[model samples]
Target: MTSTAIAIAAGGGGDVVAASVLAQRLRHRFDVVAIMSYSWDRLIVDPTPGPRGLGDFDGLTSHHELVAQVTVSTVLRGPGRSTLPPLAHYVGCPLLLMDPVGGVAGLAAQFGAASRVFGAQTLLVVDVGGDILAEGTEAGLRSPLADSMSLAAAVRSGLGLHLLVAGLGLDGELTPPELTSLLQRHGATEVAELGAADVTRFAEVWNWHPSEASGLLCVAADGWRGRVETQRDALIDITDDATIVYEVDAYGVAANSLAANLIATTSLADAEQRVRTRRGYSDIDIERDRVPALARHDEWTPAADTVGAIDRYAYAAANRGVNALTIRRVLELAGASGAGAATRLRELLKCERPHNMRPPLYLA
Candidate 1:
């Protein structure tokens, strides 16, 4: 095993929370090198194949930039109408953000260089749900682009790697049965149970930011089972196996046809286009393209129409299971306009946690 371990959330957001739990565990054995995720988000404007590092995400005009790291030390207010659960609010000492630029293969080189800087001998890429192993045709699959892209990059990264699928089926992308079948078919073996300790540890960070997957995983570890409403599909069944953690060689699991199909993909847009084409999706990223946040912008004034679209997006973002890129689409659908529409939509949204909701007292 390598002394320095790099933990990457295969997908963004709450998936990082799962990775953080694993990193906490690894700290006892190895040098926890760094934790990172794609600058992309399924909830906000982050789609469009771009590189984010040093000069990134300052004001929301998306583009490719240098391979620098953005360290988040503060919990600035979140989007008021936001409904997505976070991965790590504690975000360790300083969470590192590794934007996926230069395509999958290029990203692998970036990983290799970073691994050297951090002295990482091993790389562990984690995804909360098992969809990272999906064939892409699965019915419940909605966001395979990011996971697949990361896996492809990691496989090509030339670093020691292990793939951990934590909180299987929690994302509701794959049914309970679909996940198990994939694992078995791909030669994945049960490494250990994420267990109550992992849940308890994660619960420390979850309360300040409730995670649909973490919330479900915590209770499920205790044998609680039922269904919960999701932004996408109606409900997902919570089986006792939700807490089980499985491990497989990165190459073996990435062999899935869905993921393999992405090996030749040149850019995020190309990968997304492939998944959508295979799935026959026309309006998938179309809405995202329309969303103002996903597009480039200037410091312009906000118009009433633009404000109206923003209000509508906040309401629909969590309810409709809209992808991060669709904010402009929401604005367009709601009749928002002007170059400032994107600027205004961003300026206006504010996240206010429910007063009745409580924070996790166990993290300490």
Candidate 2:
């Protein structure tokens, strides 16, 4: 039997970075295949052309071949511009949409069947944060924990058949107790602080971090403005407002997944209030100051808004489409389930207004 392996790098630059790092490592042992939900177009590029943009995964490693298969639509618009159509039609193999909401599952399953022609597995990864244990009224839809559990259940039983939880970082330094509690609540069997080296070791596993080079793509809103020159130096291709939104959005989504409520702000004051009231911490810390900047700058934005960014970045990768059979191999190992598990999982995956979301941010 071919020792096939799959690695899913979810979220912003960090996910990509983790993917890259892991890809290099896996190349040594197994046929390292990757499923990039967003930002592959921007990450993998020919940097020799010159200075372009940040998060450019150019010339990072020569060992592994990076394959692009699926693409997720930006969350900024409705069905017309959303990624659902193209992703549903083009993916063609055991399809795994990172977060497969209600209408998207049937299509995902269809693709899965097509992929099975060549032998593959389909999987999905969802970030629920800390909103799971609430009432299922409209208000609960926004609950992070509930949302994650719901999505996990849906994929577990649905066409996707495999699910993984992404973005579970705690705001401040997580005490051991807090980490244990967080893990127990999420039903995760293992957790690790991701770094460059870990990527290679877990490259063959269904659940592993992306490459560190991928993390280069992440830019905080505040850092983008201040570090524009630095970013320009790092990336191989730089254009007018090259899509930096994906990193911001991914980071925001990941942050929201851990917090109790939806962290949002139209202005700096709103951000401060959200942090103060929800997180219950003084805004005097260095990291706290960084949060506002990350939100305000171009690279960082609220997770809900960052959907557009991820779409723009994935445009090219989606066009290429990787080997569907390889994706199926990865999904089989993920071991995710579907909707029959609970009512809470179904409710969380539905789209709803952000304000109605729950848990309130807990400031560090």
Candidate 3:
């Protein structure tokens, strides 16, 4: 079967949520084969330095294999547990993780191998935010290495990959005006907007992962295009374009920025070194060598203490909008699952906006 892999730019998780919306928007035209992502999810999972390359996994496999890859134990780390690949199995999307070990060339090779295995005709590296198009010098641009590296690998993959930037500026990395202007300069053409079904699917993911960015985009997609206030940061006037999924030729975006040069010219470490040299801080460098986000290490404590973990984690999930995957891990860490856990989760969780108090869609 002909496949089209949809890879979330940075580490997976919420990005997969965005890609799920994008895949539905594509209407199953392709197999949507492997849902590719990096292992470096710093938001919920502990931040590792570089991406947990393919080495961190048991190579490529089918959807069922994907589920087996990220067991509940794998997702739930105790107090000190840090990095874990996206609980992609929860969304029922098979995942492919690009290791940062080989730099651009290595990632390209990995992409090729996975594509060949899945018979992917086209590869699309998706970024939830439009930061994939950033030129690295943009003041607001923080994590350019992953996006730029994906862009570089797509170009080098020789597969003529497509680039999709959804919910532009919703990440607060770059404003909508800035992204639109960047695309215009890069000569990007308007591709397509998420359809009604697409919006419905997007809403499902948004409900579970009530992040500030995707929430704003979902609100916009549902026809609210005003400046939405969050606890922190400036009010962002999300435009109609927030729901629009824009694509550009990988080469064009690379040609427009010197950031692309770093990925193309140097190894992953070298490229990160250069960005750190210029930016004074590189998330890749710091996170690559960093510990697990949860800091629980691998072992799980007894079920007795799990109730406590559930209480604390539920509050964080409800109040902070930590996303569904993290909540699932919390449940797992607490030695909880199924209806009983769901009951505890509902009772413990606070805040009801977006109905995050309910069990996650994965659990439901």
Candidate 4:
């Protein structure tokens, strides 16, 4: 087999998109590049909370002897859903499904197995925003479990690890200056910057990916400079730094982050418990509580005056500080759901100069 390199997305689907962009760049360094990504998606996209495991999926192909490759046809076994299948089909590379159900040791074993099977010399753990480097004190930090787990697992995996932080502050979890300070503390070096060509490779996928942070990365790469309004009315600035990817000291980051304390976690529950105990909250808890409440009132029917409804939703969202929303969220706000919702949303947004909005992302 040809020489291979693996890039691990440090979060969920958004990180997977970021990994794909980085993996494409890695193709120049290795004959083959594969991405390992978590199945955790936002509530709007998956509905089912938490990351899905290997057994949760239906059409996964065995990768070599150990890993499972998510294909275009893969689907969740039941109520759970996945964006990995569509992502696999479009990313144009082997997209491996990484189940973090077993926590750090399990993840480490998976990492080692993939490295051995593919003869990979180095593992690149990529985070879209710099939250993986956060020390759990940033005011904006919301999701840190997955990123910290990946960092700890990769450190224990015993592979030559390279840490990359891309699209700084795009996730709205950490600001550019915050991440830059963390990077500087860890002695991270600036690597390559992603250009339009890199964004173009995945632009079509962006139309339906429902990954806000990744979409922001592409928009930033496309030279859009302004404040990007996201979920909860949080604002992310589109700056030149969003285009750069930094390679940091892997061991130093692991040693300093919440990952260090989580290194021995043998189960996901244990890891979540550790994070909650330290940070006073966990992201899974937030998802678990929020998803059901939203289900109660998230449904919306397209009003007879569709334009008026769109305008109302836009105005309401902005008043709440949200000027941009993911396609899934847009569908929810419009009270549209099921198979025809996306098409219906396309029609609804058209009257609002949706051309300015990217697919999967509506610039409200």
Candidate 5:
């Protein structure tokens, strides 16, 4: 068998997209590449708080009875939705499922099994944004559980984990300066930039996938600059750094993350509880509380009311200390959905994708 490299997208959706790029970047080093990712997605997609397990999906192919490969036909067992099936269909690679429901130890076992099954020696853990390096004390950190669990599990897997951080501040979780400081603390081993050609590999996915972070990364790789707004109206700077991927010492960075404390958790709940018990807040709890409110506020908004809707959502986000929300989210708040909402929003705002929002909306 040819040498295989396993690239695990620390989180799903955009991370998986980034992982695909990284795998291609490393093509010369390995004869084959296998992609892996968590099933966790935004509340708008999965409607769930945490990552889904193998049991939550159907039509998955068992891989050595250790992990399962997600296919285009794979569907969530319930009413929930996912980007995985569509990603599997578009990426045309071995999209493997990572069930974080088992927590860090369980995740470590899966990593070990996947490595052995694929006969891979080089293992990469890819995090789209640098939130994986958060110490859990950063003011902007909103999602840390999934990335931390990935870090903890990768380190515990005993497979020599190589941690890659792409789109440093694209997620709007850790700012560029904050992420840079953390990388300095961990001592990044390599820093390389991706160009326009690198992004074209999966640009088609950006058309429909709501992964603003990954989209921003691709835009940056394509040489776009300036601030772009995302969920909560947070404006991310799409600088050259956004296109640069950093490979840092996994163990060193893990020590600075909540990963060090989560290596023993038995379930995603246990992991979330541990974070809340120690940090006083959890993203899962925040989601559990926010989704119900979003579901109840579904009133159709007319064109004349769109401005008023934007003002209301922007004001709320400001009060929460978040800078901005994506145009898509603002439209969603205006009771917009389906395919044409984005086009209508662009027409209303007179702006285009990756450039619509120039200056920051909610200034800090």
Candidate 6:
């Protein structure tokens, strides 16, 4: 079988970490290529003398070794023009742009053969923030959500696709049922929830590097293990601020696990409680509120608007036997497929007019 050429579009350190883990797991089946759209240099640089910059890239060493040789590129130019790197410049084979929120599909289409080779299988992972959605327009491409939904619908019409939502933060009130319903509405056929244990397993399989092996020992000795055990139960009931903290701390521990003295030992419950308490402080909350929005949906209405665009396109495509895919098809392939939320969103707007007040179909 021909090797799948996969492209990962990562923005932050966390994104890079996730992509690296995925690359390691699929190395045998794929020729993985990573396209980083943000600058790690700026994120890490700090004027202060003590431990400056954000931190080293997590899993950098392992990524260099186990995964297909990784490549890093910045999407933005300086602090202004937020456009991503032209996707036309990177096309060579079947491609999948991870989190191509900022108009990457349009750019990819410009590559002609690359876009056709990937076809409806071209996928993008959508997050709550919608950064991928925003980048679509910024890069002069159609909305990523629209393209994703179209692809999903097409896949559903033909092959049996499945969806699996893994590594969802356990700190929020979002339930498996809720997620399943949402995915189903968008055209998914399955939906599964993953927990901390699953995450740990993924990390191990990826052979992540340890920054401070000794710090992990210190954390274990400092009762971190007991704390973590106690917090496991709390993780299930997480709905408020406490749970959020627990989730963040858990993520931090997971990220810093490479440090010998910094092993994450705190129970999910205690970590949650600590995070809640910390957030309670006026200064902390105030500072956190200042953090810039990472996803485009937080500010732009394009993603939401594109939901209708996708529905219209799907309906038209179905009528014409175009074999278009929708979000549901993509999720089905991922394993945690369902479309309850997407269906409801469409229904709710059934009677509403399109934002531009333009007819659903356009003719040249």
For all candidates, what are the clash counts?
Answer: 13, 55, 20, 2, 7, 77
The residue pairs in collision within model 5 are 230-326, 232-324, 232-325, 233-323, 233-324, 233-325, 234-324
Candidate 6: where are CA atoms >4 Å away? Answer: 9-13, 35-164, 169-173, 183-364
Give the alpha-carbon lDDT of every model: 0.57, 0.27, 0.56, 0.79, 0.74, 0.25
- Candidate 2 residue 221 Cα shift, in angstroms, is 23
Better of 2 and 5 by lDDT: 5
In candidate 3, what are the lDDT values of residues 224-267, reduced to their tens digit? 54443332323355578778777776788877664466656436
lDDT of 3: 0.56
State the lDDT at 11 in candidate 5.
72
Ranking by TM-score: 4, 5, 3, 1, 2, 6
RMSD of each: 8.5, 20.8, 7.7, 3.0, 4.7, 24.5
lDDT per residue as tens, model 5, 23-130: 776666554357889888766556666778888988999986767999999998874577898898655478899988788998888988888887877678898878
Best by lDDT: 4
Ranking by lDDT: 4, 5, 1, 3, 2, 6
Worst 10 residues of 5 by lDDT: 355-364
Candidate 5 residues lying further than 4 Å off, grouped into runs, are 1-3, 30-32, 297-325, 332-364
Top candidate by TM-score: 4
Model 5 clash tally, residue pairs: 7
lDDT of 2 by residue, 83-135 (tens): 22233232222122232222123223323433343243433232212222222
Which candidate do you rate higher for lDDT, 2 or 6?
2
| Cα lDDT tens digits for candidate 1, 1-364 | 4267878777765666677777775566556656767655433333332323333443222112323444333222332211121343354632555555455765676677667766777778888878788877787786677788788888877777888887788777787788778888877877666566665655544333334565566656645555444433335556767877778668977776466776766665677677777887522364455455434433345455554554454455446432222223333443333334433543343222132122211100
Question: Which of candidates 5 and 6 reaches a greater TM-score?
Answer: 5
Residue 360, model 4: lDDT of: 50
